[model samples]
Target chain A: MIELYESQRAMRNMRRAAMQRGVVAILDVGSSKIACLVLRFDGSDPSDENIGSLAGQSGFRVIGAATTRSRGVKFGEISSMGETERAIRTAVQAAQKMAGIRVDHVIACFSGAGPRSYGLAGTVDVMGVTVDEQDVARVLSACDVPDFGHGREVLHAQPVNFALDHRSGLSDPRGQIGNELACDMHMLTVDAQAIQNIAHCVKRCDLELAGLASSSYAAGVAALVEDEQELGAACIDMGGGSTGVSIFMKKHMIFSDAVRMGGDHVTSDISMGLQVPTATAERIKTFYGGVVATGMDDREMIEKGGETGDWEHDRRTVSRAELIGIMRPRVEEILEEVRACLDAAGFDHLPSQQIVLTGGASQIPGLDGLASRILGHQVRLGRPLRVHGLPQAATGPGFAGAVGLSLFAAHPQDEWWDFEIPVDKYPARSFKRAVQWFRDNW
Target chain B: MQPLSRKSQSARHDPAPSRLKYRFERLKLTPGFRFCIRVVLPFALSVGAVSLWFASDDNRLAFNQMISEVRETVESRPEFQVKLMAVDGATSIVAEDIRKILPVDFPVSSFDLDLGKMHETVVALSAVRDATVRVRQGGILQVEVVERVPKVLRRGDRGLELLDETGAFVRLANARADYAKLPVIAGDGAHDAVKEALALYAVTGPLKARLRGFERMGARRWDVVLDHGQRILLPETKAVRALERTIAMDQAIQMLGRDLTVVDLRLTQRPTIRMGEDAVQAMRSSNTIKAGGE
Candidate 1:
């Protein structure tokens, strides 16, 4: 617990330092690729005038961006520190060279780590005056931290809502006269070792780790529109090694989970089913991967060339329907896992059940229709928002995590560290408020 | 414990009907259509991309050339080129400065010019309060600027700077002589409190000839210094009312014309006056002489 607090404090100081330096790097380390974006801050805080709309417009610009094939990473987690560090260095160095400047601070996002969300509530008596910064801090401290078992650490602790007396949903409770001040905070916890490994990997790349966020949350921030973010939406980032799911409401991520199966599984299945090389299987999958098969597929044939020294065997072809048969079950399984995660998150209770599919694997032609049927929600394919100077290749759904990481670096949502928590009120194990928080929010 | 178990089971089973309905609705999509939409089309598109990749010897080069050509044609249109720039709502000197800092090349495509960045660059100038940049008809890049109006000439550690009505620095002046017509203020933070100084100056309009300048005391309140060596200490808040009262008292009793060194209006309830050494000596001698005469 003490280690968790120390890590949070260190991250906060690093974030402040990054903002002061006027330039920072956003690194998205995934199984398929490692992307780096150099963001130049104009030293203006994101104003509350437009709120959710245009939040990412005025604060930062992407001066440089670069992506390289990832190595030694599997399921969005660093499998080999040395290899991942080399890949990160390559990506970051290219971006820095293009940006014509060196950045020491970097904020990274990944899709693994088994993220879990908890809703915590806290209430405190306003210090007899208007609700001030100290009062808000005290209330945050008053929220009970749940026992998330061993080897787990908190990633994001955000104040999602504030209530002053009987007035609920106050975005900010400062300067308001109230006898009681209460807050609803969303806390996301992940495996501690997963974060430490990434931190160690980044340190090896000679960059300071300023912050960390789940890639699913980052994708939600990037792909969903303002209305989707406010009204409630689910973002499913289908990547090479894993599929990440996150739920957003009022522009804050309330729930997040990830499935270990991803597009790589589908490729592996195809390779095994067709007796082809992994590279050839990936190429065929990208060109012909679909969950639905039609009569036309049976007529359309794909040449399966091989270099086994048998000319006749090398020139053999297979019907596209056979390929579809190999791919559909894995994609369906991944969606079913996503649906289970969403159900566990109580996603149906939200006012809007819009599901946005993003990331590289989501480019499949009819995944949205299949996902809509399976997830029982209105589904749409999402790509990263257009950012200035972004290369054409980096505009695809594959770069959603990277683009969202840039936005997160520019205008980070207010977190627990931004407040001065009262020293006297350590987090208590009050299960009552936790239950009440779930009742009030869910 | 039995009741709790029953409640949990009930909660888990509650969504069965909705789940059945959803499944039934999804079953409406026939297998053939689903297979076509999901599998066949995606396979065809991927095969097409693969064929395009394998067909040409310089596929990447061709693609790059095509993209560049399309971009060039779109950007090179005459309507997109900014032939000239016209700066409005500024003096010739300020307009020249605006042009110097803009860093834009003539006959460049307007699409290449980031108007928001240009506006920020123009607003960074000390003389500009705000600026708006737009492309007009006939390939003209029009820039409209609102210049900060200088209200006071402040002489501080950084030398003389013109201050706006809000006490913000507008621009630097070479010397106080250049802006001698404007009211002068000195000391730290005087540039930020030009509003109060201007208000005091307004109230002392009748005595403008005798007023030399205003000095900021400790970055709070003000000291109105007169040419005849009289200093009026104004309170931090409601200094205008105090200045008005002082002016009224001076008009009623000729208080300012007397040889008073300081008028302390910091305590508004009871105003105190400090006499000059010579005036005190003269009063003392007159009182003694009157005592001797009696």
Candidate 2:
């Protein structure tokens, strides 16, 4: 954990260096596609009262964007190292070309790897009259880190809440007088192997791993509006191979979990149930995929075509109702898993439990109605927040993770490792004074 | 049966640039690397190549030869050739002296002629006050000159050299009789006081028949000698004013015509006269006769 803390601190330093350079690249390794966006931090006027500025106070603009079909990636985790590296190269190179500038630092995100969240609380007496940055760091270090099992890496550890004595829910408690300083932190851990694979691929590409974030948390940051995040909302990013569930409260992610099933499962179901090729089944699913079958669907027939030699095998027809029947259960299963995750995270206890579904798979027709029915009465389809110079084609729900990664690069949430570990036994003032006396005499 | 997604999926080319090419493209995008490639590299390469090529002795010689050859052809153009020398605003003698001192040949290229040095040489002659040498149109090396006309002839060690108004030597005369129109001054350092000598000579216009020349005695004061071996001594400072005072005395009292040997005006407060031998004798005889008669 200490080693990871050092490395994370090093990465934060690299992020600062990249910010000084004014250019950084964001990579989202998703199950369906690998998206790369080059963000240019122009360090624009901070005093300008322009609310519509890109990424708010951090004026970063997306100068170049490119996406390529992902290969050797499963459930949003790199499965085959070489192929995934190739795909990443394809996307990054195209984006670099479009941007006309080379980017040396990359902040990457992934959604799979079974991310697990832990809430930690720690308290310490204020070192002086008022709480200082050192005291805050000491309190954070005082938090007892869980074992989290072996071969697991901490992805994100953010202080979700702060309390100075009786005052709770304090976003910033520094310079506030208090006898006791306590902090509630949200920490997410994923498989270390997944992180290693990503780091290795990025190393092969000759890029510095400046930072890493969970795709689910990133998507929540992008999809949930300011009000929803302030009140409380759950963003269910229904990706191709997985559906990520994240709950944001007071502008911070409180809980995040991912179901291992998504739109791919629905396509597989259609392929298996309709006795058709996966490609044809995928086409049919996109054209007529839905969770709620109607009476008029039975009359609409879809040609699940193939080029097989057998004439009967080449031509296969199924009604739209049957296609919906095949896809509806799979979608419902994914949503149910998300609901279970929310329930486990105590989503009902939040002040406002708004559920927003967004991702590549969230584009399913009538999914909002179906999600509302299955998950909660409040459900809406979500898209990524618009940013400067983002292509119109990449502004859909599918690009939530990529867009969110850009925002993360521009303005990253502070993590536990961002602070220094204050040395316990520092030299006393008397010793320094003695040295000063010697220097004066000499 | 046709698969609807075939068109979209067909011919999917995975465009992963090679490692070298990808890195090269990135290097091209880097501001430092791009600057090296687009600006520094090209400049350095050209400079290196040129320096390398010219490092060879034969090549250096050839390059220098080429340059000189081009310069020679331009210099030898007919329009640049100065065919003749023309000296104006000078006497024939000064012109001859200018031609003798200048080291140039006719039909020579003007580029090979150093006009500034030629003008300095021409102006070096005492007769020429100033000269400007320029290659004029119609292929002429024209030396425009301003010659100093001698104001007074000084009989010095150089034997009657002509001096201009500022006491600058212009030329020498065979004898003082040749320049009778000019006042003759003879002294150890008389050229330096030509202006005063000339002014004194002009004041003697009334007694021009009796005025001989000025002798600069002890190189401090002037003594104007007349036809009868009589002289008027002048003070060093304001000699011209002293000479004018003497001329007024002469005009009023015929002072120079009397039997007086010298009129000394060296001390402005005192005017003294020395009698001639004849005048002294006559005065002595009259004194004896008057005594006897008394």
Candidate 3:
């Protein structure tokens, strides 16, 4: 194995060890919720061939998970450090209790802060008949590293696929005889400070940092199938504080985007329309929110206690039609924005014909029909895939990233190790996260 | 008597040096040595100053020359001669209308000519299938690219640009390439998988010389074809190994010499072969039954 590859594998193995002892945690610090899953990994002998290839590839099983309502976060930014830390701790402890283990290593995901995408291309001639690992590294380094803004940094810069002369879409060009090799890579950039803030919050919870992924990307991994990923498909994860969209093709995410409006906005709309408290409106929306109202729905009404302490004016009923009327327009608006994002991503231009909807807000009644109409394509409600030993509480769309992070941890995509990192003969630290912990720690 | 007495006294005492002798040893620095040191110090200092001035001037000139050489070399290279194709801060520039960006004496020689880069750029055009880039001795870089002509245009909310196995996506604004018989990838991820299948096809080599179309079954695996639609189902895993096995089977059985469809290799060990429509229906039916029993 190459030196860099070995080192990365060692690091991953260390993470695997920490996760396997029933103490690995995943922290999803989003605008809407701070979810923590303390997963107890069931270890199989790494050298055992049967275990190594249980599913023709690597696999993992999850044992515990938990989530908590977030505070001090607004659209993915940590405004109050102490409050966020408390939320993270609460979620982690709850998950640990459920798993019956103590967790120390955590992999976290975050959404919002306006992620941007860029396309970079590179090429190199194969010195030998077969493309070797060195050739792959050389071509990747040959790609012009784009200049993101001063404070922003590249989080994920991956060679989605490669093409040989006259042939395209080669996943691993190595060991194939080719005179020349070229690669089209998708790069994602985010605010460096935002990443540090998330890491800091997790650190405050006393958990070791294992890895980090964009929330939208994690959702795409769990929601999209191999076929949808191989061709072209878009995943729209609508959470409470933000709606994230990720585009996948060739089993890799090519584009990721997000809008700062989600389930919370719909709840706010319901509260305003019904003239009820925000809490009551939330309960009503979850129970009876609808995008399309029928004649039967118009006659049906519900009773609610008024705020005024007058028993005589206590009960009032609003038709379900009225509720649908208020919710449909807002849902339509969110979908329209999502459609715009897809258009901006040039989604239709891709060979993609399928659209998957996930996340907490995605489960709303009649959302699929509304999304299909607005998105102008086939839309399906996506649920997180089944993994071994997942608790029933974690089966909701709200747990998508937490569950997917578990899967990603089990079967990781090719990282820097899968190929070699071109050494300017310098240490990997040159490329490490510059802002180590949040500047606020000072 | 005095000399003998002094010798006896010295041997008896084995005495330490007297104060006068100790003082003489302490003040060993003499005027002659001091005069020589004082004269040499000023002369050495003057010589050093003169040499430092000349050395600094020479160093400055050398630095200037190196910078100019690097600048000249970089300026001479053609815009696309470098594999990176970096138009630094020139996002507004169009790749097609880049004639003006080409440097006059671009050093095509120094530029590493990677055919793969040219192939990738061409494949990205959605028009090209097979791309070949070559640099002659005279420093002329020639690109001969064959494009995947769209057989059917897929209409969605946004206009679609589809390429065959190579993932070439041509914008709607761009002129369509001449190869129109190539089938387009329709579903999501289809375009990318088609490219993967094509790449896997390259490994097929001699067998690819007999292939017709490669279709991706959306989220499922590939359904490959030989001349006139002979389908081969490649399993999701061990794809490369399966391709190798298929080639071996082709050579051993001379299957490529005949018309066939649905060569199922989903099972790693057992390879199923379905004869093409050109074969006698009765015979094909009999073959399926016989193979099933086996």
Candidate 4:
């Protein structure tokens, strides 16, 4: 049952096993930081009526957490492979030491390249009044596995919708009475090599690869409010190495995209423009970065330290207006590129007008006004929601994706799990009927 | 129950021993089997015939008696009626007009009343797909039918017609219904092409209801119009997707205002708009020529 869905099977089984055994570990392998959290599933009450929250029955409890600054990674890719392997080992070791458990299976989340989308449709026939496991298997088998691009393999092909006879847009069509059942699935794919790289990193850390998630999608799960998710919303996560954009509708991520530049670029701009060290530039950005400048800022000056160890050079100062003039353009360009991406996504057609900005870069002062100007909508800064035992330090926008990954690992979206596998094919083709597809798949 | 009598006992077992005796007696009649049996068998058969009688055609075989009674009732008159002329492919044509078109095909005779063969003959014509002709009790024949409607009106090398979603071509000239609404597709090989022009209209539920025509711009794209005068431009790769995006965007931007003239989804994410006179002018130039032509 656990191995039925090709992508998330192991993770689902591991999560279930952890719940039965009372512990699970979640790992987030991001460019800026590597995060780990040990969760304890309290499934005695899976029903939400006792929880008093709109968020569906969340039965997981986090016991221990640790995050280490990531090293040996550049542009969200493994540049120094050995250094990356060592970094992952250090993060997992430190997390294990704190949790007091030798965790085996770890669900990982990462930001990188080679993200693609495909639409696959499968059909199955209903032979009786009540749709059984065989019916579910048949419809899943009938899906037309599209010819995804060469050199790329599918990572996630989950059924997004189901149709029964003349009725369509059914989220679940299992119990309905109809002669035919069809499903339209949206599948996400990534570069095979990128997946293998992450898998290798996890395997070297003495942990099994339970699952993988796009960084943008995980952050959206943590950042977006319920209404925003239902009507449609975009999450712009400005991480240290990359800025990820994910669009959600009907509480599911329909599109996930990332730009290769983010908060680090802003720090680099400040370092180059002010002729200061990288550390000092980061401080200045944290204290005084602004996309919009005030009239009084021209007279106001910030004390800048010189590169050398000379007292006279350390006394240098630059006007705040000058810093704004230097920083505003780069921020504007990033927003313009984001606008281009949104236009590419055809964002103007969404039903709502809300945009949530989260991440290290999004924390900069006046970035909201700048984003609203460029994205052309209502914009707000997003912070990670409070979950059981989430550390105060790990609750910031920078840790949104990591925290969301923890929650996601604990209670994943049950996508293709209910689709009982037929005897014939794991990825069923469109030509087979439901029962025959199930027979062939199983 | 009465006690068994001698006659009753004989009646119960009468045929059993006789059947055995009959088989045994046949063994002794070798010479008589050919000559004597032939003479005895005819006499036995005549005796058997006199005991049984059978009726044929029930009591209705007395029609000869009824014909003599009918002969005294009315004066004789020659059978006369108007002729029916049916045009090929006009399966739904009325029978009264057949006399006006070709007045020599129908004749007033009881033998000529079977119109099934004639109906089949007309339906065999290239212009006719199906038809039905029936004769009434008053000697007047009436016809009612349903004709095949052309699916698509195609124009490229020469004017050819299409039927159904199969994209099959109809060769007959002027066989299409008068008020039937069919799209005119134009391109190099668009005679039977099932591309974006057809798909864009097929997906959008509300838009499909008001579709007026489609103009194929080569094999790649389409520009279409709704009956209420809304125009749409669809892309090649994800035509259905582009349509869905357009619908979502329309709800968001309220771009499909009552005065909207054109909605374009060709540019990946950007929706180009044309309104007022420019939209009307563009629509007229693109859709006017090939739309309602005969």
Candidate 5:
């Protein structure tokens, strides 16, 4: 835990250096595509300061953006280092060209890596009459870190709640009269090997990994609105090889997990059913893929074009209803897995169980209708929030991960600080001041 | 089942740039590198090329030759040519002297003419007081000379020379008879006091018939010399007034017509005259006879 903590702190320092230089690159490495956005910070807003409606971002402009199809990546994990490096080079080089600048520091997000969330509680007696930062630190260090397996590393550890004496939910216990201080912290851990792979790939591309974020948490920060996050909401980010589920309450992410199944599975299912190539399967799915099938879909046929020597084989077509039939089950299976994770996390107990569906795969027609039936009643499709200088093509739901990574770059500690936890050095507060961690950090 | 993904994907080259190409492009995009290429490189190249071209002696000589040839062609044009020189407002003798001093041949380019130097050369002639040299229309080099009018003649060691009113030498006079009507001033510093001499001459109204010239005495005072050898020695300051007093005494006593040869007005309270030898002998013989009779 100490080792990862120091590395995260170093990455935070690199991010601060990038902010001082006034330029940073955001990379969202997903299985389907790698997106890069170069942002130029034009003002001196406080680091991790909630300056805008979305909590902790202000005075930044997107100067360059590019996306390339990902290679040698599956379920958001780098499968081949060399291939991932080349893909990253392609995106970064294109973005640098558009921005006409050189970028050395990068903040990246990924959706795979098997993230696990843990809730921990620790108590400490106040050393002085009133609790101060030292007592807060002591209580935080006192938290019993669970043995969350050997190979995993803690990505986020935050003090979620603080209680003094008998009163509970004292978000900031510093300088308050209290005899004993007890705190609850949320810790999210992911496979260490996955992070190492990402860091190595970024280094190979001549970039320094300034910060790392789980794409699910980034997606949750982007897709879930301010009110939904404050009340209670779960963000579902369905990508090519994985679907990310993240629950936010009182503006802090409590749990984040990824299901190892996504749009690629549905495309494969269609490819197998129609005896077509994967490329053709993807095109057909985007054109005719749906979750709810009707009688009208049977009449809508999609031609699967091919240049094979035999005419009879090249001209085969599939009805839209048949395509929907092949896609619906895989998408349902992915949602069912999400529902299970939410149920396991006790998502039903939240005050507002808003489920926001976003990402490339969420663009399927009638997805919200299907997700509402299985996930809960309050379900809607979401696109990433708008930012300055974003290209119209990148504002789609597919770029939620990339946009969220940019927001993460604007405030690097938002993902690593465990906002629900109240720590001093890494304070990215969601309910800060208990009054105005209002849009990002209070 | 037909599968054409491989053929289509293989038809086009990979969209991702190679590692070397990407690095090269990033270097190209760098602000410092871009500035080197965009501004400094071209400036340095052009300057180098120019300096290299100018390095050879033959090239330098050829450039200078081209410039001189262009200048010559423009200068030799008809509009710039001076066909002749015209000397205006001078006597024919003075004009001839002026034309002799100026050696400008006809049909020379006006650009070759140094008017300022030419004017100074013409004005330096004793006969010409002030002159202007200019190239007027119709290819004429016009020299307008203002010749000084001779006011007095000075009989000096180098012979008599005509002088203007300001005591400047106008020209050499061959003989005194050539200018018999002009007053003759003779003495070492008489020319230096021409204005005073002219003032004394202005008061010599009654003695005009007998007046030869006014001679400067000791370069300070004046001695009025008449044709009969009568001379009046006048005081230094207010010599003109002393000369007026002499003229007044001569008008009252007709003293200039007597045997008096010297009227010494150097001492204003005492009036003394030196007679001729015959007059002094006659006065002494008459006084001796009158004493013997008494």
Candidate 6:
């Protein structure tokens, strides 16, 4: 828990340095690929005077981008520190070369480590004066920090909503006349070891770790349209080794969770079922993958060429329908797990139920349709918003995490560190406030 | 005992609906609408105040005057005062011209100086192609300018002025003799057509010494006036190519030196030449003798 506070402070300091430098790198370390994007800031402080108009929109532009096949990473967690460091170095170096500027600060996002979310509420008397930053800080400090067991730490503790004087859902309450101030904060915690491993990996690459965000939150920020974010939406990022699910409302990620299964599971299924190599299975999946099969698929034959000299095995062909059959069950299981996560998040309680699917694995045809049927929400396929000077090849769902990290680097949400947490007020366990928050929001 | 037990059950069931009704009544004012009121009411109040203030002339004047006074105090800080101005990326003459055009007062507060307006004023100078004005460290106002490079010298009714490559007015020439190396153009609107004249002069590389100037004809075409009072009329379109053809013909036939007053290449396919008056009369008399002999 102390480490959480330290990491938050370090991240804030690093973010300030990156902003001063006018350029920073955004890295997405996933199971299948490590992507890096170099963003150039135009020196406009995002918090300058237009807080109401430019709430969630960022002002950074991508100047360079590069990606490489990930090594020593599985389920979005670093398995081999040395291998992951090498991959990150390669990606960042390539991106820096393209951008013609070397960057020492990087903000990285990953998905894995059994993300858990807790909602906490805090309230305080405004001392009969107009509410200001200090009051907001006092209220935030009053929120009870839940006992998230051992070996886990908070990744994101953001004030999702604020209420003043019995009125709720206030975005910002400063400069307003209020006698009482209340806040609902969403805290996401992940495995401490996973975060430490990533920090170590980034340090090994000789770059300062500026910030860290959950890949699901970053993807949702990048892919979900403004209305979807404002009303309510969920972004399900299906990567190679993990599926990240995040729920957003009012431009804030209120809940996030991840399932340790992704496209690699389907590829492994195909590899085992067809007795083919993983590379061949991946090729076949990318070229001919689908969740839904039709009668026409039965007539379409996919050649399964083998390196062995055995004529019978090398010359064999299988119907596309058979491939679809092998892939659908695993895909359905992943979606079912995602649905369970969403149900646990009380997604149906939100006013809007739009779900956006994005990530390298989400590129599979018919996934949106299948997701809509399974998740019982309006589903849409999402790709990252095109940033300035981004290459044509980099404008794909695979780069959503990288692009989203860039946006996060530019215009990070006002987090707990952004405010001065009043040191005198310690968190007190108040069960009544928690229940009241739940009732009000849900 | 049975009647008493039945009475307890009936009493317990009777308040259930009323309790539900109480809960519904409590929930009538949703947090969302309350939040809306909380945000909208203050915003609307401020807007109303502003509109009312703007609607009344006296109030508006008082408000604006108060704002200006506050701004003046904040801007008059010693750190915000610009003590010096430095000009870069221009010659001494052009820089002097830029200084004259800019409306900045020396040692004035930086806030009082509208940098955007200053930039526009500097760029409006004939010599300045682009300019950037910024407050540098140490309260120094830095003005960086890209001065236009003169490509041609045009003699106009307003005297000689230098023209850049794009035929835009640059600055008044200090002396015509100083820019003698540059090709000179004259006549109305020739300043705008300096580009075509320059191109024609470029292709006539061998005839540079004999070429004097270009006269813009009807503000459309060019009449290439040479040193020996000989002129070549060039068409508007492809005037460069026509000049090139004339140069080629001159190199082949020495057509320019053959006592001709005008060479018309307007119809590029058939060039017509008007001989000198004396030369035309000599040819006519010689033609009569040749007819008698036939």
> DockQ of every model listed?
0.01, 0.54, 0.00, 0.00, 0.61, 0.00
lDDT of 1 by residue, A130-238 (tens): 8777788889888898999899888988999999888998998899998999999999988888899999988866679999999998999889988999999999999
Model 5 C-alpha lDDT per residue in residues A1-442, reported as the tens digit of each score: 4566668878888998998998899999999999999999987575545454535555688999999999879998989776688889999999998898999899999999999999889999997799876677768878898999988988777676789999997867889998999988888889999999999999988789988888998888788888998899999999999999999987778888889998888889988999999998998888878889899988988888888888988888878888888888888899999999999999999999999999999999999999999999999999998888989989998899888888767755433232232344344553443443342353
Q: Candidate 5, after superposition: displacement of residue B206 in Å?
A: 4.9
lDDT of 2 by residue, B1-294 (tens): 224563563325767777888888888888988888899999999999999999999999999999999999999999899999998998888888888898687889989999878877888889888888898999999999999999888878868889999989998899778888988888777877888888898888787887778888987889898888898999989888888899899889988889999999999989899999999999998998989864
Comparing to the true complex, what docking class would candidate 6 get? incorrect
What lDDT score is found at residue A298 in candidate 1? 98
Error of 1 at A440 (Å): 33
Across B211-284, the per-residue lDDT of candidate 4 in tens digits comes to: 66676666667666665578778876776787778777767876675567778878877888777786677778
In model 3, the runs with Cα more than 4 Å from the true position are A1-22, A45-58, A311-314, A416-418, A425-442, B1-294
Best by lDDT: 2
Query: If both were scored by TM-score, which would come out higher, candidate 1 or candidate 2?
Result: 2
The sequence of per-residue lDDT tens digits that candidate 1 reaches over residues B213-251 is: 899999998998887899899999999899889889998
Tell me the tens digit of each residue's lDDT in model 6 across B1-294. 124453554334222223344234323333555566789888999999889779999988998899999988999988898988899999999888877777577789987788888888888888889989999989999999998999898888778888998889987887878998898888878877877888887887888889888889899999999987899999889999999889989999999979899999889888899999889998988998889854
Report how closely model 1 matches the true complex, as a DockQ value: 0.01
TM-score of chain A of each: 0.92, 0.94, 0.88, 0.88, 0.92, 0.93
Candidate models: Cα lDDT each: 0.86, 0.88, 0.70, 0.68, 0.86, 0.85
- TM-score, each model? 0.57, 0.87, 0.54, 0.55, 0.83, 0.57
lDDT of 5 by residue, B1-294 (tens): 224465654425447777789878988988899999999999999999989989999999999999999999999999999999899999999999988989988889999999999999999999889998998999999999899988789888888899887888999999888888778888878878888888887888888889888787778888989877889999887888988898889889898889989999998888789998889999999999989854
- The residue pairs in collision within model 6 are none
Q: Give the runs in model 4 whose Cα sits over 4 Å from its true position.
A: A1-8, A45-54, A123-130, A426-442, B1-294
Provide the lDDT at B187 for model 5: 84
lDDT digits (tens) for residues A31-74 of candidate 6: 99899988888776656666524453446667888888887789
Candidate 3 C-alpha error for residue A98, in Å: 1.3
